[model samples]
Target: MPELNVMSEPSVRPPMTTGTGKPLSVTALRKTYGGVTAVDEVSMEIAAGEFVTFLGSSGSGKTTTLMMIAGFCEPDSGSIVVGGRDVTRLAPQKRGLGFVFQQYLLFPHMSVWENVAFPLQLRGVPKAELRRRVGETLEMAGLSAMSRRRPRELSGGQQQRVALCRALVYRPPVILMDEPLGALDKKLRDQLQTEIKRIQRELGLTVIYVTHDQEEALVLSDRIAVMRDGRIDQFDTPQELFERPRTPFVADFLGAANFLPGRVEEQTADHTLVRLDSGGLLKARPQPAPPPPPQAASRSASQAARVRAAVQPGRLALCPPEHGFCTGTVEAVTYVGTLVRATVRPLGGAPGDLVRLELPAGHAPALGERVGVTAAPANVSVFPDVVPDTESGG
Candidate 1:
């Protein structure tokens, strides 16, 4: 895919800070249903004007946490703070948050202008002011020419744009989007993702967007909270999350990875040496270990053992068997435009265990050919082997 150009020229509109687009803080948020915990102690801070996404598979507690922030779902425990004011118990309408869902919940009978103007009307803005704001918002969304059209008369993309315009027209402090582009086609989704980022930056809006689409999260979010089994496994900038994933679940979910069981042989502040189960010594860079919790600092020696290592497919390259880290036989190879993905079964791995490698289309190995796989130490990520939930993936 071509690199995304999200840093376009800023809009010329004057900064309008309705509700001041203030910072949002979700603290120890908890929710449960029928003896099952849907969200557990979820906590995050979204800076004013920052775009943060809750990304995870279905039932991972991302959506539940978002609902709690929007005041649509009351939490069993925890606080929801917007601009330093606690709104944990506020009604959805009283929380002053704009929300857009996957379904374009436009009024079928109302014209585009009417739909965009609904929130201002509810707030009792003067009729003249409502018309002016609605007109400006419609034009901003490039729907000015279709202002008189009804929902049924517009294309799916246009309808979704109308939904976005409606959410932005009132300029609430923070906007919460739940899979807003989930129903759109790829072309439209890409277009809207660009527009959403542009609009958010132009208006300095603090947005909490939720989506199961990893690419979308990477493209749009200033930071992402990767959730699993009702908890955030890791929250960090896109580059950090992908390059230095703190856990196996995050490493696997963010991209394709090959997990090789290994035991640490030597460690230092910056690097680690591991002996793979296949009997190859591999070097890998290590992230600084987080300070152990006060309660766990005094644990027994066995409880402080080192973990396994993982590497991305893109990081591994094919080389002559004697010169590479591990020797493998290519089981299959498929051309995918710019790259050829080869599935290989290593010499000492169990049957059915395979590693995938993305090679340049011109140099990919033929099926059944013996090859060696190697990666730079910096490209490998080592973490404790915490089995991920069965439901977590791209």
Candidate 2:
């Protein structure tokens, strides 16, 4: 095995501000309400002109963190730095953040232009300047033509576009969005999703977005922070988060995963033999080098770090089919749009360990057919353990 350096920091973009002026940073961030901990010690830095997202399920602390950054909630312990200065206790308005919500939150009596102008008006900008600013924001939000319409007069998507314009009218440096598309239907939500990306990119705005939808995060963010129980469990670019998840929870949360529990049975120069508790032997490629002696630790640390990085080795499952090992009668099959899933009971598989294979729909083997299951090395993802490795063994 190659020497593994466990302390290397991953590459990340530096925090910066948007076109407006707001900047954001959180250090040792924590939020508590009575006895309940709503957010743990979360630290983040958002650079200017970057789009970052808080992605997780409800109660995962994504929204709470967003609220803290927006100055809507006070952190029990932590520092929020914006524009290179600490503003942990500043008022929301003083922090210069524009916030949007799932609901349109527009005034029923106001037209789109009036709604967009409201922020400028509150800031005491003159009518002439406010009108110009509102017009610019309306155009940015693709709502210039609907500027005269009331919120009720627009479709859900149009109302949302107006809300976005209102949020941007004052041109705050950072925009905090809390599931802003949640209230829209699927088609409208998808449409607005693209629009949000385009607008954020074109204007070079710093955006901190919150969403429970994984696909949304994948599509919208340059990077994602996955939260669990008020703490950030992982933060990385979406591709790294998906293809090389550092934890089982992240892997499972992102998509369907087949977890095969196992133990290292033996190790050789080239491979580690892992014995699956489910009764199969898996061949895993070894790290390129082994740890160096203590006296040379520092000299070899960097080299070891590169070798210890996660490897994208292919995984295999024993089953009856082309390249599969275990043979069994098909128990059930379900046809989805492009693929068919087959549930089969292998000779040694536990009740819950029944294997599922996704094949092209029309080519599915019939139910009750005796067949073999095969896995291509590249089709499988091998984690050192069913759980994340705390120390290097792979």
Worst 10 residues of 2 by lDDT: 305-314
Q: How large is the C-alpha RMSD of every model relative to the true structure?
A: 6.7, 12.6
Score residue 18 of candidate 1 by CA lDDT: 41
Best by TM-score: 1
Stretches of candidate 1 off by over 4 Å are: 1-20, 287-307, 392-394
lDDT of 2 by residue, 1-394 (tens): 2211211222332222236534578899998888988888999888887789998877888898888888888889999887787878988989888899989899988777777777777788876566566666666676777767778999988988888888877777888999999887888888999999988887788899999888889999988998888878789999878775656567667654556555555566766555555465555455223333344455554432221112221122324454344566689888887877777776566667666666776777778887775554323344543333222110
lDDT scores for all predictions? 0.83, 0.70
Off by over 4 Å in 2: 1-23, 266-273, 283-322, 325-330, 339-342, 357-365, 369-394
Residue 303 alpha-carbon offset, candidate 1, angstroms: 12
Q: What's the true lDDT of residue 370 in model 1?
A: 91
TM-score of 2: 0.78
